[model samples]
Target: MAIEHADVLRAAHLARLGIDDADATRYVGDLSRILEMVDALQGVDTEGVAPLAHPLDATQPLRADEAIEPDRREAFQACAPSVSQGYYLVPRVVE
Candidate 1:
């Protein structure tokens, strides 16, 4: 696909880029060549191949889920400056 210089300028405007006229001309040509390479890749054939996220088939070691004893809540609450109905009390921000 042939990309025009105007398209490059429009993309630069959308991206908030300030490209010099010299650079914008060069970028238009470079981007067009990149698109041609991507178009070439579309001609390749791949049959009977399973898609894979990784080349290796290894599993990570995991720890078993287990229940733990509750910690001392009363002991920790004793150090609070104010407590009401088993909850911490603070100065109200709203009326």
Candidate 2:
């Protein structure tokens, strides 16, 4: 796929990016190369290949699911200026 100067300018305009003539020319070449590489990659045969979640075969060690801290909801709520039905109440700022 070839990336033209007009395509670069249109993309830049749509993305609200400021690109000068020199930069746009450079980007046209860069984008053309990228698209050509993508086209090349699309030609590869991988009919029997299974998708990989990770490249390396590794397992993450996980800690046991257990609570270590004591529940102190009432203790903390006692310091709040306003609390109702186990919920902190703040002054209404919106209509």
Please, what is the TM-score per model? 0.44, 0.46
lDDT of 1 by residue, 19-57 (tens): 988999999989999999898966777577677677789
Segments of candidate 2 deviating more than 4 angstroms:
45-95
Please report the candidate that would top TM-score against the real structure: 2
Q: Residue 6 in model 2: shift from native, Å?
A: 0.2
RMSD of candidates 1 onward, in order: 12.3, 9.8
Which whole-number lDDT from 0 to 100 does residue 80 have in model 1? 93
Error of 1 at 27 (Å): 0.6
lDDT of each: 0.88, 0.93
Residue pairs clashing in model 2 are none
Candidate 2: worst-modelled 10 consecutive residues by lDDT: 51-60
